[model samples]
Every structure is written in C-alpha cells, then in structure tokens.
Target: MSSFENVTVLTKANVYFDGKVTSRTVQFADGTKKTLGILLPGEYEFGTDVKEIMEIQAGELNVLLPGSTEWITISGQGEFTVPANAKFKLEVKTVSDYICSYIAE
Candidate 1:
C-alpha cells in the first residue's frame, strides 16, 4: 500500500468530507483516521457513501458523524473511520490556536 501523510491548517473555517465532518484541530497519523488533538471547536457529520479511517493525537478534538450528532471531545489522540459518501458539515466555534491535521493514503 502507498503511504501518504499530509497536514491541513484551518484558520477560520471547518473541514468537510462529503458527509463526514470533523474539527479542523484534528490530526490523522499518516493514512489512518485517528485524531491527534482538539485544537478548536467544530462538528463532524458523515454520509452513507463515504468510507474513511481516522486517528487523532496530542491536544484535543470534538468529533461528530452520521447516525449521531453529539459532540465528542478527545484529548492526547484517538482513531476512527467514516462510511462512504456521507453528508457531513462542520461549524468552527472557537479556536485559540491554529488547527493542524495530517492524513496518509
């Protein structure tokens, strides 16, 4: 499998993934959908056709996906995945520091 790692910085908006959404202050290690930390405030929603795995680390992050809209606060790090083609949205609440997220594919 090809390994890919990338970082995304959100200044004033949230990151939307088809139907899966997450806080911008979230980081995924390489190719996993794990969370690194919660850098800011936001909501994550997922569609039914979107499929992805995520991981989080470090600070803290609030996560939201389809079937559930409750906000999840995470600190240090964590991991999760989204289904395929889901309807997702994010609302940037407040952020003291810039949000950094990494993705590997």
Candidate 2:
C-alpha cells in the first residue's frame, strides 16, 4: 500500500517461525534501514539492539511491550517503538504486513 522508490536494497532476510514469518532488508540512501515483511498467525518474540519503529501496513497484532503486562493492539497503519536493547512479544491474529525501521541509538 506504500511505495519506496529509489531506495537501495541491501539483502534478503528470512525469519522462519515454522514458516510463519519472513522479511527482506532494505537500505535507503540516507543510511536508514528497514525490514519489509509479513507475519503469519502466531506468537513471536523479537529482540532489538538498536531502537526500532515497527509500522503495521496491514492486518493487526497484539503486542506486549518491554516490561509491560498489557497487550496493545496495533491495527493496520498503526506503529510502535521499541527502545535499544529491549524486546517485545507479538501475537499475530492474522497475516500481517509490516515495515520495521531501524533507528540509530
């Protein structure tokens, strides 16, 4: 639903959660990197070394952020940020498309 023209693609990255999740890495001209991916219905945990902003492009997700017991719902076009060296858990209710931006710490 979005366009990222004139950007440099770094490489292809695949994350297999029993073939439930996968992603590709993209690099922009400004040294910013992002992962455009999809998540099948499942529960997953992810760790981050740098700050990251995850933008939901389609479908929905229930996320338990770092140090939180409450699960926050992120619908299509919604976003959430995770701090450096933090981790987050996600419950994917449906097939979800996402764009995860990596930020410099």
Candidate 3:
C-alpha cells in the first residue's frame, strides 16, 4: 500500500548499529504492529521474537536468511520473511528503506 490510514505511530525510534539503522513502530487497529526503518550501508544481524515479513521499499542489499548458505540480493524493492526466534544477517549496500511487519503466528 502507498499509505496507511488511521494508524498509530510511536514517537520513540528504534535505533541500532550506533544509529546506522533506525525505525519507528507503527501500530494498527487490529493489534498488530509494523516498523518503518532505514538501513545505512553496513552489515547487520538481528534476532526476532516473532515471525517478520520485511518489505524493502528502496536501495540495495544482500540477505543471509536462517539456515541458508546463499545471500539473497534485494535491489530497489523486494520482500523476505524470517521465522520466529531466528537470527538473520543483512549487508546493506545502500541506504535502504524497509517496513517490517511483526506477525503473531
């Protein structure tokens, strides 16, 4: 979707990698939450407590998903999913914009 309506956006930012990566939580009415974030050119690893669907809006990157020997490349726009309680790696080639939706299931 191009935009989200009637959603609540948290004021506090989620920062990581010494401010190289930052995001804000967006809460929907259905009790689900998503994060809109920016990732600078760098390598980053993240652990998830829930299944996450990452929607890449812009820029380029390579993702190392859990139990994978290959790094998937995402340029401009792409999407990837990570299982709950798993760790994944990302190599951001450029300033990447993404929205990550936290799934309860």
TM-score of each: 0.40, 0.91, 0.98
lDDT of every model, 2 decimals:
0.45, 0.89, 0.97
Scored by TM-score, the top model is: 3
Model 2, 1-105: lDDT tens digits are 458988987565777887799998888888888889999999999999999999998988899999999999987768999999999999999899999999996
Better of 1 and 3 by TM-score: 3
Using lDDT as the measure, the top candidate is 3
Native-to-model Cα distance after best TM-score fit, residue 12 in candidate 1, in Å: 21
| Clashes per candidate, residues 3 or more apart or on different chains | 42, 0, 0
**CA-RMSD of model 1:** 8.6
Model 2 / residue 41 / CA error / Å: 0.3
Kindly list the per-residue Cα lDDT of model 3 for residues 1-105, writing each as its tens digit: 699889999999999999999999999999999999999999999999999999999999999999999999998999999999999999999999999999998
Q: Taking the tens digit of each residue's C-alpha lDDT, what string does model 1 give over 1-105? A: 423357544454454543233353434444334232233454544344336555544445566765666856555555555556555333434441322323333
Global Cα lDDT for candidate 3? 0.97
What count of clashes does model 1 give?
Answer: 42
